[model samples]
Target: MNQLPFFITIPLPDWLTERLAVPMHLHDDEARMRFVIELSRENIVCGTGGPFAAAVFRAADGMLVAAGVNSVLRLENAVLHAEVMALMFAQARLGSHTLRTGGGIHELVTSCEPCAMCLGATLWSGVARLVCGATREDAERAGFDEGPVFAASYAYLEQRSIAVVRGVLRAEAAAVLDHYRESGGVAYNG
Candidate 1:
């Protein structure tokens, strides 16, 4: 009989490490979305994972907390989406299960709108803001299923005190998804 593993490890690609070695302080929404969009594009160019990326940042000062690219195909875990990975890393880095602590407020920025699982995680992640680039329609057009996200989803987040901002750089972010589809990228959820 095969032994059962008790622990799970999700590793980021080496290129991500190299890219994050520099200090990043994006002071505005557009800058942060552009950075996340670049990471999504690079994820495709490097053939590492899905064409999606997310980052958690200090809302007050624009200091980066953590960043992640979609690792579903690479890590063989369907739940390892970019937003989940970023929130996980951010929680680990801050040594708290929730980001709403006395230290400071944080925000999550993603290259594309989050799916149902990621949106649920965002609410539990305790981030004060949720910033998105591309829309669910953009992802769907690229053959990806966004999974039950709707206008009420934004309302739910807002009701929970999480400020939701969408379409920060829609054109650039949607272009990445289009490029991924054109280049024969797999839509794991489709």
Candidate 2:
């Protein structure tokens, strides 16, 4: 199979595909599950972190899988998370899951709470999973007209959702933007 280079090295689309179809979208369920774990490791405080902290995972074919976040991030630092979304998307693109390979593909995206504008980004990640952090009530309140809905957020704003996460080669996922001074090629594997 063909493998797309990592975001650092490859010329990824301006946006990832998180649409709804396969091969065209950006996320899926498997990736979403892993995203939950990734967010937890990032010290985002799943449920307690705030309302803004959330993760969105999709299939390689742009399918919505799972979304989780801490309500505090949403309530307090919406803009900060909003700005960091580009990072999250890049991470998701570079971060591949078992589902993202072969005839079957998968992808994921995660962020704290983001308003209407962010959704637009997920729509482009070319994945099947469409998941993010939102209060249970908020999810219910928002009511996705898309399809079968799942909750990645908390209801109490204090509750947390837990899921196992796994991924590919870890390069500078933690390092700050300045860390990549020379800018090595991406380690994308499928």
Candidate 3:
């Protein structure tokens, strides 16, 4: 028997790549919402990957630690969701595998509700909070195949002391998905 091996790579523009060098400070919830929406739009326009994107922030002051757009199609990796990418980048920037620090809380802000893999990543990311823009139904309505995420999934997060805020700037985020569908972007569900 033979075994096949695969690798993952995300090609980002110079500007996007430089985002890690500077600290992102989002003053309020509105700023964080705007950042996610813009990140989604940029992903679509720049042809990075999917229409979704995510950002990690310091829960204490809403300072953006890192941002990531989906790269599933670009990397040919099914688990490369926006939230996962953002968490990965955040960890890299902070030089820590976990986001939580001593007396400091981190937040995950995503353009849409997380699928199963991303949801699991969030739990393990060490972020103290999760804020989502669109819901699972919204993604399905846009023809993106999202993994099964039940209401209990959210309840479970809350049970674990992870604050969950859903449907932040939903229409704007959903509009990005609609645009992606209209633009005929590839919806690769692996």
Candidate 4:
């Protein structure tokens, strides 16, 4: 379990599929679009429907920067969950936790604003965290249930995101993200 370096895993919730479907992600455009497109393969193929688009301009203007996927997606559980996990693992491997907090104005490194699902994926993705706001403040913005979110989930007969963490503390991620950014760390945006 500890020796696995080729795989990264992040947890997912029952609603990730739907959440990912929404257009106009408020943060990094390229990363959000790639995540949504990859997760919506079935919907895209049918052509009957899908939220696919070349660009989703939600924040005045933005551009796609990075893209990637170094893991396999069985979709046995849910594509969104698998993708998030793999991405997270990749970030940690690249050492994205150098940006620290509490240094007289604590450089925020300007992390992208994560939408609800992105927030969930970002936090529980097994990557480090960044401090966006206060504990309760951020939680209110997440708009999801309480978390120290896990990698496995059960969603009736449909599908669900997987859990990837053991004893993940919610704020722990924020702290880590903070370091990742200020220390010149980077994320895949995919």
> Which ranking of candidates, highest TM-score first?
1, 3, 2, 4
Per-residue CA lDDT of candidate 4, range 1-190, in tens? 5675686444332344354344332354234434434433322233222111111121223322112221122233223422244344334434443212111111110112222444454444332322222232332333322333222321210132221222123344243334334443322223
Better of 1 and 3 by TM-score: 1
Model 1, 1-190: lDDT tens per residue?
8699799999889999898889889999999999999999999999999999999999989999999999999998999999999999999989999999837999999999999999999999999999999999999999999999889989999999999999999999999999999999999994
Sort by lDDT, top down from the best:
1, 3, 2, 4
> What local distance difference test score does each model get?
0.95, 0.33, 0.84, 0.29
Clashes found in each candidate (C-alpha, N, C closer than 3 A): 0, 77, 0, 20
TM of each candidate vs. truth = 0.97, 0.29, 0.90, 0.23
TM-score of 3: 0.90
Please list the residue runs of candidate 4 whose C-alpha ends up more than 4 Å from where it truly belongs after superposition. 1-86, 89-93, 97-119, 124-190
lDDT score at residue 93, model 1, on the 0-100 scale = 87
Candidates 1 and 4 compared by lDDT, better number:
1
**Model 1, TM vs. native:** 0.97
Candidate 3, residues 162-186: lDDT per residue as tens digits? 9999889899988998898888988
Superposition error at 172 for model 4 (Å): 35
